[model samples]
Target chain A: MTEAVLKVENLQTHFFTKAGVVKSVDDVSFEVGRGKIMGLVGESGSGKSVSGFSIMGLVDHPGRVVGGRILFHGRDLVGLPDEEMRKIRGRRIAMIFQDPMMTLNPVLRIDTQMIETIQAHEKVDRETARQRSRDALGQVGIPSPDERLMAYPHQFSGGMRQRVVIALALAVNPKLVIADEPTTALDVTIQAQILYQMQKLVAEQHMGLIWVTHDLSVVAGLADELCVMYAGRIVERGPVGRLIDAPIHPYTKGLIGSVPSRNPRGQPLTQIPGMAPTPIDLPAGCPFRPRCARASDICRTTPETAEHLPGRFARCFHPHLEDAA
Target chain B: MSVFILRRLMQSLVLLCVMTIIVFAGVYAIGNPIDILISPDATQAEYDRAVRALGLDLPLWQQYLVFLSKLVQGDLGKSFVFNEPALTLVFSRLPATLELAFAAMLLSIVIGIPLGLWAGLRPDSVAGRSIMAGSIFGFSLPNFWQGLMLIMVFSVFLQWLPAGGRGPTANFLGINSSLFTAEGWQHLLLPALNLALFKMSLVIRLTRAGVRETLLLDYVKFARAKGLSSRRVIFVHVFKNILIPLVTVIGLELGSVIAFAVVTETIFAWPGIGKLIIDSIFVLDRPVIVAYLIVIVLMFITINLIVDILYSVLDPRVRLADMKS
Candidate 1:
C-alpha cells in the first residue's frame, strides 16, 4: 500500500454533557492509504460516526476532541486552529452524510449549492465555478446535468438527491472522503448503483475513503479493510476477507453471525446478548465482555490491541484463533 | 405557474367575501351608529330623518345587501365623520401606515437576524448570553410601556429624537410621504423603533432557534467537511435553512404592524390608519369601520398569498411537482 493519506493515532473525542463525559471515540486509530476503502462497522452510539466527524472537525459543542493526534499526511490536526483546519476540509478531505434528503440546503437551487461549494475553497468566477459544478453532476452519472443543476434539491428523487450530494462532494477534487453510511437510506438497486459509482470514482481519483456503516454486507463487498467499533473503541481491525472469515473479537463474530443469511431459516435470527452501552460510564475493560461467551477473569482488565496474524489486530485476551484454523 | 396563481386568487376572492360578512356583522353588533351620528338635542323628526337617510332604519341583513351592491359598483360609501369616500379615507392613510410598517420591518430584520445568528452560533459566549437575555426583555415588556420607555430614553432623557408627530414630508402616491425626506426620518425613527421592538425580538428568537437547530443538521456538518469557512456555513447554509421560518413569521408580523399599530401610532401621534380606525370605531362610523377592516383583510390575504408562493420558492419539497415526482 502507498503512504497513508490519513492516519488517526490514539484519537480521543469526548462529549462533556450535563450527565458526564461521554467517550464517544476513545483511543481510536486507523490508516487509510491512497485509493483504499476502509469500513468502520458499528452499532448506533458505538462511536463510528463520531470518528468520522472527528476527522472532519465537525464535532459540535459539548463534544470535543480531548486527546490523540490525527496525522493527515504528516500534519497533526488534533489542535490545529479552526482557520487552518478550514483549508484542508472540503479541499483535501470531504464527507458524505447518511441522509441525502437532509444533506442539501432545501431552499437553494442545486446549481447554487454546487457552485458555492466549489467557490468556497477556490477564488474563481461564478461562470467557471458553475461550469465545474455542471461537469461534476455529469461525472456522478446525473442525466441532463444542465436542467438538474438549475432545479432545487426536492425536484430530484431520493436516489437522485444522493447522487447530487455525491457530485457536490467530488466537485472540488478532494483527496479523501469519510462517507457516513452514504447508501444506507437508498433503495437496494440505488444502493448498488451508488456503491458501483463510488468504487469507480475512488479508483479514478486515487482518493482514500472511510465508509462508516453497520451493515456487514456493504463493507464486505466494497471495503478492502474493516474496523469494527464497540463502545467507543475498536475491537478488531484487518483486511475485510480475513476479519470476516476469521473474526478474532467476539463482537465482530456476533455482528457477522447476526446477518440473516448466515443463520439457518425457520429459526430465530442470531442476536447479540445485550444492547450497546452508552458512552458515559462504560466498563473499565472491554465494553463487550458482558456479552461474550469467552469472557474470563483476565477479561476484567483492559486488553491492548495486538496483532494475531499479519496485518490483523484484535483487542482481546481470548482471541478466536481456532476459528481461523 | 399561472394556474397556481389563478387558484390562489380564486381562494382569496372567497376569503375576501367571508371576511366582509364577518366584519360587517360583527361591527353592527357593537352598537347603533345612528346614536353617535345624531345629536341628542335634535327633535324626534330630525332623529327619524337622519336614521332613515343613513339606512339605519333597515334591518342588518338588508343594510349589508345595500353595502354589497354599492361595493360591487366600486363605491365603498362616504364616511359620515370625514365626509369623504371611506375607501379613499383608508387608502390615503395607507401610505403613512405602509411607510411606518416598512421602516419597522427593515429595523426588525436588519437587527434581529444578525443578533439572532450571533446568539445561536456562540450561545455560551458572554455577548451571546447577554443578547439572549436582551431578547427575553424584548418578549416580556408590554408594547405600550416599551414605547413609552423608548420615548423617555431617546426623547425625554437623551433628547435625541422627537417625542411625537409626522415631520416635513414629500408627495408619494399623491399624498404626503415622510419616507422621502430626511427630517421626516427623524420623526419616523422613534415611532418605528417603538413599533419594531416586539417583532425584532420575535425575529431574533426565531432566527436564533433556527440557527441553533440547523447548525446541528447533517448538511451543516457536511458543509464544514467540505472545508467551507465558518462564514459560508453560517450565512449561506444555516441562514437559508432558517429563512423559511423567518419569512413565515415576518409575513405575519408585517400584516400586524400595518393593520394594528394602534399603540405606537397613538404614542408618537403618527398620521397612520391605526389612529383613523380607532377614531372611526369610537364614533361608530360603520362605513369607515367596514372599509378599514376590508382593506386590512385584503392586506392579510395578499401577504399570506405571497408567503405561500415563497414557501414553494424556498423549499422545493413543498411544491406540487416535487411532491408528485
Candidate 2:
C-alpha cells in the first residue's frame, strides 16, 4: 500500500461556549493513503465536518483543536506555524465545500479566482496561471472553459458552479483533498458526475481524498474506506466493503438498515430511534446508547475502540458477529 | 450595458423633472424671498422694481417655466444675495466641498476598513471590542458637536491647527484647491477629519459586519483549506467579497456625507456648498437654495447610477443581461 498521505489521530476539536464546552470532534482517527479515498460518514451533528475543518486548520473562533496530531507525510500539522501551514495548504492539501457558491466569490470571475488560487501558492506568471485555470475548468468538463472562466458564480447553474469549484480545488493538484459534503447541495445526477470525476482525478493524480458526507449511498461506490462517526467519536471504521457487508457496531447497522433502498419499497424505513445527542450536552458513556437497540449495561462505560475483526475496528461493548448478519 | 445605462438615464430624467417641480413649489411655499430681499420700510415702487428684476412678479407656473428654460440653457438663475449666477457660485464652492468630501472619504476608507477588518476578524478580542465601542461613539455623536469638540481639543487647546475658514487657496489644473499648501491643509484638516469621523465610524461598522459575515462563507474556508496564507485568505478572498457591500455603502454614504457636511462646514466655516447653502437659507436666497437642492438631488441620482454600474462591475450577478426580467 502507498504511504499514508494524511493521518489524523485522537483528534479533538471543542467549541468553548458560554453554556458548556462542545466536543465537536473527539478522539476521531482516520488515515487516507495516497491514491485512495476515505469517506467520513456521520449525521449532521456527528463532527464529520468539524474533523475535516480541524484537518484543514480552518476551525474559527470558539472552536479549537484542543488535542490530536494531524500528520501529513509524517509531519505533524497540529503545532505547525501558520506560515508553514499556509505553505502546505493549497500547495499540498486542498478542500472542497458542500456549497459551491460558498467556495466561490460571487463577485469575482471564475478565471480570476482560479488564477489567484494558483498564484497564491506559486510564483507563476499571469499567462501560465490563466492557462492552468482554463485547463482546470476543462478538466472538470466545463464546455468552453474560456467563456465559463469569464462568467460569475451567479451566471452558472448550481451544477456548473460546483464543477467550477471542483476545478478550483484540483487546480493546485494537492496531495490530499478534504471535501466536506461537496455534492450535498447538488442534484443526484450532478453529484454522481462530480464524484466520478473526483474519483478519477484522485486515481490519475495519485492523491488522497477524505469525502465527508451523511449519505452512505453516495460514498459507498466511491470511497475505498469508511469511518462512521457518532456524536464526536468514530464508532466504526474499516474497508468500505467489509463495513457495508457486516457492520460490527449496532449504530453502523442501524445507519445501513435505515437506507431507503435497503428497505422494501412499500415498507416504512427502519430509522434509528431518537436523534443524535447534541455535542454540548451529551449523555455519558455511549452517545448512541440512548438509540442503540443492542445497547446493554456495559454500554454505560465509554466503549474503547477495539479490533472486532481482522481489519475492522468498532467502539462498542457488544460487537455483532459476521454470522449474525 | 448601453441599454441599461440609457434606461437608467431616462429614469433619472423623469426623476429630475419631478424633483424640480417639488423644489420649485417647496421654495415658493417657504414665503416670498422678496420680503427678505427688500425691507418692509421700502417704497412700493422700489419693491416693484426689485420684484420685477428678480422675476418674482410672475405667476408660479410661469416662473417655473422660466426657471426650467434657464436650467435647460445651463443657467441656474442669479443669486439674489451674491448677485452672481447660482451655478457659478455653486461651481466655485464645489471644488472646496469636493476636496473636503474626497479627503474625508479617503480617510474613512483608509482608516475605517482596516479597523473594521481587524475588529471583525477577532470580534471577541479586547482590541476588537474597543474598536467597536469607538465606532458606536462615532455613530452617536452629532457631527457639529464633534466638529466643535475637535476644534476645542486640536485647535483651541493644542493650537496646532486652525479653528475655521479656508486659510489660503492655490489653483491646481484650473480648479481652486486649498489642499496644496501646508497652511491650507492645516485649515482643511479639522473639517475633513470632523466630516470623516461619522462616515469613518459608519464604514468601520459596515466593514466589520461585512467581514464577519464573509468569514463564515464557504469560499473563505475553502481558501484557507487550500493552504493560502491567512493574509491572502483575508485580503484576497474575504476582502474582495466584502468589498462589494462596502463599495455600495460607501457610494451611497458619499452623497449623504456631502449633504451632512452642512453641519460640519457651518461649524468649521469651510467655504463649501454646505456652508454656502446655510448662508443662503438665512438670507432667503431662493435661487441659490433651489439650485443647491437641485444640484444635491442630481448628485444623488448620478451617484446611484454610478453605484449601479459599479455593482455590475464588481459582481457579475448584477450584470445588464441578468437584470432583464
Q: Give the per-residue Cα lDDT of candidate 2 at A3.
A: 96
Off by over 4 Å in 1: A266-269, B172-175, B320-325
Residue pairs with clashing backbones, model 2:
A89-B226, A89-B227, A90-B226, A90-B227, A102-B218, A102-B219
Compose the digit string of candidate 1's lDDT tens values, residues A1-325. Answer: 7799999999999999999999999899999999999999999999999999899887877899999989999999888998998888888888999999989877789998888888888999999999999999999899999888889877899899999989999999998999999999999999999999999999999999999998999999999999999999999999999899889888898899889887779878878898777678887788888888999988889999999878989999998888674
Question: In candidate 2, what are the lDDT values of residues A141-182, reduced to their tens digit?
Answer: 999999888888888988898888888888988999888898
Count of steric clashes across candidates, in order: 3, 6
Indicate the docking level reached by candidate 2. medium
Going through the candidates in order, what fraction of the true interface contacts does each contain? Answer: 0.89, 0.88
How far residue B168's Cα lies from its native spot in candidate 2, in Å, is 1.4
Best by lDDT: 1
lDDT of 2: 0.87
